[model samples]
Target: MKESFNKNDYGFWNSPFQAKDLASKSISFTDLFIDNGVVYWGESRPDEKGRNVIVSMHPDGSIQDETPPEFSVGTMVHGYGGGAFLVKENQLYFANSKDGMVYHKNLNTKEINPVTFPFEGRFADFSLDSKRKFLYCLRKNDSTQNQFPPTEIVRINLVTKETEVLFTGSDFYSNPSVSPDGKKLCWLQWNHPNMPWDNNELFVADISSENIITNSKKILNSSVGACYQPIWSPKNELFVTFDGNNYWNIYKIVNDSFEIILEKKSDFGRPMWISGTRTFSFLQEDILIVTFCDNGMWKTGKIYLKNNGFVEINNNLSTIYNIAADNNQFVMFAGNSLLALAVVSSNIKEPFKFKILRKSLDDSFPSNYISEPKEIEFTARDNKSVYAFYYPPFNPEYLKDENNLPPLIVKIHGGPTANVDCLMNPKIQYYTSRGFAYLEVNYRGSTGFGRSYREELKGKWGIKDVEDCLDAVKYLIQKNLVNKDKVILAGSSSGGYTLLSTLVKNNKFLCASCTYGIADLIAMTEHIHKFEAYYDQSLIGGSILTDKELYFNRSPINSANEIKTPIIFFHGDKDPVVNVKQTEKIATALKENNIYHEVYIFSGEGHGFKKAESIVKVLDKELKFFQKYLSN
Candidate 1:
């Protein structure tokens, strides 16, 4: 048995981690919560046709699927759905993706019932008021009223099946949190031209006996910089994660004044891309467990209320999410380089150790096969520092050839606002274990570093982000870490725009792959979801009316003729974020110019690919494209 575990020479590019296996074995966990000692979470399974199932773990250490096979728990409230399910007592309420209806399931009797009818628009971020027998949530309005849908905070009577709009003037709404006593409610809202992370306000209102919202006032004003995750502690005090000082820190409202609890130059909040994002939980009246981003790496820790002292918990997790606490115990979705993303639980007294309730992927593979990322910083073209996570080639069975440098895969994360951490991502491993050095760039505009860093790409979207990617590649090549001639570029969504923009400015990469990337900034500004309706306005520094020329000049579609590298384009026809026309237009131009390229438009996919077959097909196509152009 020991001899069988020994390394063998299979060489790079012949990795056992095939794309088909990764697609089938991979699971995405989200929206975690704990109730009555039962830990529940949502799992999006690719192998099951992207069916999202609600799973539960009992104290007896038994795990079971709470969602029926006929239903998929998901929502389209923000196009990037979240907070799809919530639990109260023995009832599980979730939004079914197939018909966009909210359903209530009796956990004990296993009887499913629809609570909301179709045409009521989509809903997410649910908060149950058991005393009032009402379910509060954020709902998107039908598009019939306007091109971009408006969002509202609404409450539905659990008994009468009637929904009442609690508030409506905002362009977007999320995080409808009911107070512990169910006598008050708080939520986050922002107007157009501002993302939830860019600039949003938190408001609180007292509920009347007639269920009317009374004395509704903005608790945390918009000027306080983007506020997120308005959660009430067990003591019923209103709290939020504020970024007023550039770093997201936990702040509690004490007599109309914001008091920072455990002040640190780290982000205790994340961008509200999806609904129901929780980063901190009160384990007790005084001790709080928080997942914070410290220097781009995520860490879980405990904050003592007595003196605002913090102590990091020692767990085998680099990234943490959806933290929920009950008394001394807390559960969350956490993972690190050696461990796959899983539902883990730990107590306040035993923070150093945790038990994995469920894993997103099988971690039975040999530990030696894992390639841990090294967080690196380098000077960019603009002379500012850029951050990235570099994963060197590692295959237990394969030995490196000192004479030759490995090909490099430089990735640009989407959301020009999003940041990538040292999590155990199978896609990154698939390339690294196959003799490829993977560089995941957390460009200037990415979150977690600080608000200033996140706002770096504002008005200079194409320039700053593209330069950072170029600088990262230059830094890696100059360090003799990767083969200069074999560097490849890849990105999706906004990252894809960066990839395309980078290709236009330089001819460094041998080839590139872009998935659902924006090609025409002007077109995108004219047609996109309300969540990002004004996203390009901030990115371009002005609206289309004021910056038409900048939009045209910065858009990669207009400069498609300048790109000399062979690129493959992948897009979803049903993408609500970046229109499929974005990719199709660029491909048409490339074909017209006789540039070597391939285009694949997956059916029934949104901004991101979810179906296992689609993911497998895309990965296979990408690997084949890279191998065809990779030079030794």
Candidate 2:
């Protein structure tokens, strides 16, 4: 292990974790589950042009890629897809990214067949009926002219090879969890003007012998708050996480009333950004293996239904994703700041004893070369508390002058609704290992915190989020931890909005990088996808019609003349969200204003860069841009 700290190390130390490792070697695992003693997950390979391959691990610890190279296991449902695949009785069903059709693969025979015809729409959040004769999922129809599409819970008859719409009325539907006995069906639904995390309803219906859904009734209406992950227990009981008391807690629907199963100050549920996100799984009829966010860190535990008691499972992992119960054990993808993301499993009784099935980064670096983050809470401009993770410069091999301070990199996470955790992110480590002081600001509006804090950015979108980012830098500079003149701003998506807004509002940083970020809120509202059509309305105070001035005024593109800091923008020409034109328009305005700026449009890339070459180019250019500006 390399020594963790050496105050003598220079500020611009060299790191072995180069941009190549970050782009090509650091793998990302998502949508994990287990079936019939086999662990399965969606592995994204940058080297393969960001192809998502379905991988499976057998009981004997044998691993193999299940999907063929031509077939990438992904979907475009709701624009941001998840729950792309499911397995049953050796039959693998997955949505193909190329055609938006669901495919079936016989694990035994390795024969691939298309289950659904090619269409403009997509299918996700897959669920199978009791007899496996029908597949249930949320089917999104994108042919509509409206930005928001008409989504329905549909059942596909496997024997007949036909699709049947089971339920339709809501603007969006997800999490179609059939009862273990197959007699009842439960799912979540929310309409326009309200995002899933803002407000949604949970419904349950009786399933007829003929496979028709009837007697549909709302079981829980989150009119005041939000609800997520409605799942059925082994004994046919229904449970979900509700954020009625500011914090998302586990609740059980009993006699038409929600009974708190476990109450905590932390959030048991996260923002419903994608489909098929599972935070908890039933290990048995009365036990649940779960993960929750506590103070920005995700922790796993066991919940006893009968006693409403909980026991913290000491798995060293601070970030856990896509958990599924497998017999008496649970399998998941999890890792912390110092650990690489891996496919891990543990017995319900001994949940801490993790068995690593696979690792994204197989090779480990010297301990001293890594810089660990320290969680910090600072007061915002409004006196509200803002949380961030601070990582100081660390390089054991080099030494720096005692009087000098390191340059700062303020990383703002996207989502505006999402929060960052202590994950082993190769991207963050890429800069920190090179002696940059990194800070990830969990601004108000970010999840993981209580509902009140998360809602603070509502109606204040660009304003408060921008304030928090600026406040974080001011706090660091006041503490003498970072040089104010050498600070760099970086963010993507909504975070990019905050970055550009900050640069326009104040000139506290040297240079900044924006990736597929929003520059014109007005244009974004017009080009926004169906899933988040109304997201800006809630965040920015009102719709385009109601608050047109606010939209134009909050947009960074409108105030490009106010920006003096140099910036480099990376955007995907085919991005569905935050149209590439947003970046182009802003760059044009900057050019007219004679402000230093550059824009790189990558071909075939989208909201997030997936190709290794694109990732490498962005990082390489960003490093040089920041270094050049810092030196000046």
Candidate 3:
């Protein structure tokens, strides 16, 4: 199976992975749950206008779309929605995006009915407690108050449809889990100036026999860094993930003290951007199943709590989500070595067979054309260490020219709070296969490293992110690995903003390509959604009210005149996060200054381009734009 390496000029520009091949007809799984030998998840179908529906596996092993065409089982709460549906005893409870009402569906009868009154409010991060006859959830509570929003944790009676506020006074609340006996409630709480990742508290409350919370106390505080996914064992032991020293690790509360279950540099928890995120589950309180990220590679493992030992479950699986255990078998949606996936459930015992229940994609792509990224670590301009993934250009038939260097396309990931994992991304491969050496920078402030490293760009967003990205490509050029003259910058959302920011500060790159990126920090803070309203406050050191000059100084629009290269921008007209007007303003500025730039707006797209046509067009246009500049 070994083949020869291509020796043609780098950036050869011809490969098997083309723009036309970008359309993936297969479904992508998200936020799945497993119960009683049945698995249910949301299927993101790009070909269906980016429509998302609940999908479930039948008893006969057939897969069916559970949510009808008229209903989209999604939530708008927190802007980024997940854990939108809960299943109990063959009944599905979900809040549809169309009506913002919780709907109940009988899985056996295939009949659906509205459970909550039709309203403009949104709900997410739900849990069903059949014993209390209540569905606990985190709601935005627009129907109550907004100017001083209190993160409302409400319980809806499944029978009477009456909503009662269980807890309030915290700026944010999530993951309201009820104990099996329905006598205790545990949830996550964090005030403003701190996101769930920055700092959060785990609160446990005693519930009365009448379904009332009598007393509550914070079991874990902000000194813990951040806490997530507070759940109780069958024996009523409190379990949570906490970042005590530098990494997110699991611990159990026993006799009012923390008992470390597992500790490592890896992250057992991710940022709680959306609700209902879990990285580990306690099976019967003795056997623990965990998924952790070691340098952006996700792996599932089984931990023996007694010996404090662990064994990795599957090595080839890249990304695993929605891990739940049923008896001796665990089911989860996982991406395999081929970058395609299915609902896989495997027995915990070794030598047990791994069964693929339902497949999401079956492209059967040739192995020769796929280029896997290698982890790269280098010193930044600040003399600090930085991490990124370097993907070398590859082609089975064409050889790179020894004298010509490969073009570099540096990607800046959004969230800047989030890190890019080592998963096989077709989008990056589409360019890498065609001769572009890609580098995905997990710049300062990006998570997955330790806490200090992630908060390095706390008040230095534009400065640190831009520095890390430039240093990455500079490191490549100094090492004679890539063509310095043809380097390009690309990112989406915050990454897009950094992409544009890089262009403003440096002129070495050929052009900048951004999708729905931030052009004005001031504008973004003013109009950004509720979930991220305080984002710039933390990223920019403070809000405009506190740091007016820095806000203006950090925005890309202030330095738009300094751009020395062409730029191409993409925006979805329907994007609610960063308004389309932000993109339009930048486009108008480019015209006024006579700077070379092109702007293409999609009619029905949002913050992220999800539609097949939008994705295909963006890829094609960006490719053409880069090619035009490289030739010049």
**Tens digits of per-residue lDDT for model 1 on 252-288?**
8887667888778999999888887799988988888
lDDT of each: 0.85, 0.86, 0.79
Tens-place lDDT per residue, model 2, 124-183, is 998887385788898887666555778888888777778888888888888998888899
User: What local lDDT score does residue 448 receive in model 2, on the 0 to 100 scale?
Assistant: 90
What is the per-residue lDDT of model 3 for residues 1-632, given as tens digits with 9 covering 90 to 100? 21333423345456666554566545666676777777788877778877788988754687888998998777767778887888767889988888789988998898998878766588888878887679999877777666544568999998998888888787888889888878888898888768888887778888898787877887744355888788787677788888877888888887656677888888888887766667877654678888887766778888877787888765477666657765565776676435656677776665134677766654644557767777789999779999988888876766655766888899899987998877667777778877889999988898777788888999898889999998898889998989888889888899988887898889888887988988988888777776677878878887788788899998888888877778899999999888988888877888888988999999988877768888889988998898888766
Distance from true position, residue 227, model 2, in Å?
Answer: 1.3
Candidate 1: C-alpha lDDT: 0.85
* Candidate 3 residue pairs in clash (backbone atoms < 3 Å): 7-399, 7-400, 8-399, 8-400, 8-401, 9-400, 9-401
TM-score of predicted model 2? 0.96
Off by over 4 Å in 2: 1-11, 130-132, 143-147, 221-223
